[model samples]
Target: VRDVSEGEACPTESGFIADQDRETIVKSSMLPHDSAPRVTSPAADEGSMQHNISELTALCTSLQRKYSELQAKFQAQEEEIVKLKDRVKVLEDREGVAAKQSRDDAPIKGGVSMQGRQLLKESVMTQRRLQGF
Candidate 1:
């Protein structure tokens, strides 16, 4: 057998090369297997891919259910806060009315007290003037 490097030449049959030109053979002839090995079936791979997709879909569905529950709770809390705000507004209005009523009553009571003191002073002044004359 003739000695050859890996890419230098074909594994030639001696009689054929001498009979023909150099270009007739190629490097593909040197490979060990004539054809590729068939291992994975398309049907089995498709089933596995479908199973993974189904599991992901179920997980997403569960998350959506949890999100809806949280959304409902948030809505309820928001409504409760609004009700509390309205109650606070009513209480503040009542307090404002009570303060104004106290202010109005104070003026009326002060006026009456002033009038009573003025009448007492007039009576004392008239009695003193008569006693002097």
Candidate 2:
């Protein structure tokens, strides 16, 4: 392993530098002459990866909790809809029963009966005729 100087190109064991390696070399060469290339140890890289993993895990947990809350709310709304539907059904049944009862008691109600309605109509016609229409 000979010491490679600045501006000198070195071939790897594969006899070619990869595009990423070439890019890194170009970037390092573009820095100021007084500044050395920054290097990180393998341990530092591992620590950074661990930190990212922990943050991702926390974000995933938060999203899961939010999803669970939304799902519960949806279920509660569905239950409320079912209860409202049942109430509407009960009201419709009561209205049907009331309508049937009203029909059955029509004659007993007197003024609402067909005969009473005809008499009222005749009385109105008589009054209108007396008043010259």
Candidate 3:
């Protein structure tokens, strides 16, 4: 590449210089006028990049907070599930006790066979009917 200050001809790949570059010279033929490419300062580019980084950091922090909230909610739900299971176990134990008590309270003489218990029940029922109760 030829420097503009050197005044040396800029080399063209096809050996024929395009007229677009020649038309850009205003007062000094060595410098381009309106057609010069706009240059952005390094500081401005750095500031933009820093802004993007700050936005990303804020987004990451927000996501982390949401994740923590969800994790806490999930833990609470699990604890609730455990508590419900314990309650169910207690209810099942109470039901089992009530069922066992009912069985023990059933009308039947001790040491009686199943057939003797049935005959005793029928006799009692017949006596009840005769007494009109």
Candidate 4:
């Protein structure tokens, strides 16, 4: 067994510290007293590393899929928002035209046209002259 310092990680044959050794070193450091370093065969370490790598890869794939789905949903919502804004603009334009048309067709006074006002003025003047008042 190789001698490793307390809290020091042992590097594998590949020159990288194994995940198990890292975890063991971290756990041993958390203890109140120093503990003997646990050793395992190279084959066992390799197997453990492969398993950890597989789990990490699976987790990465799942996260990527979720990110893609969220991105698609975001894009769809953006498109919907644009469509709604355009629809609102069109409706506002139509409302403005309709309001202008209504104003152009509306009477000047309360339910009375210019010609109606002129006839009413003439009738009042003629009645006043006939009554001598």
Looking at candidate 4, what is the lDDT of residue 48? 99
Query: For residues 89-121, could you state the per-residue lDDT of candidate 1 as single tens digits?
Result: 999999999988766655654455455667878
Question: Residue by residue across 4-38, what tens digits does model 3's lDDT show?
Answer: 79888766765454555455544367665687788
TM-score-based ranking: 4, 2, 3, 1
TM, every model:
0.51, 0.53, 0.52, 0.54
Weakest lDDT window of 10 consecutive positions for candidate 1: 19-28
What range of 10 consecutive residues in model 3 has the weakest lDDT sum? 18-27
Clashes of each: 0, 0, 0, 0
TM-score-better candidate, 2 vs 3: 2
Candidate 3 achieves a global lDDT of 0.84
What RMSD does each model have against the real structure? 18.1, 13.6, 15.4, 15.0
How high a TM-score does candidate 4 get? 0.54
- For candidate 2, the TM-score is 0.53
Name the regions of candidate 3 deviating beyond 4 angstroms.
1-39, 107-133
User: Which regions of candidate 1 deviate over 4 angstroms?
Assistant: 1-39, 108-133
lDDT of candidate 4 over 1-133, digit per residue (tens):
5567666656666555566688899999888874777789999999999999999999999999999999999999999999999999999999999999777755777967567788899999999999999
Query: After best superposition, candidate 2 residue 110: deviation in angstroms?
Result: 11
lDDT of 2 by residue, 1-133 (tens): 5457765657666545477688899999988795678899999999999999999999999999999999999999999999999999999999999999878757655538666787889999999999998
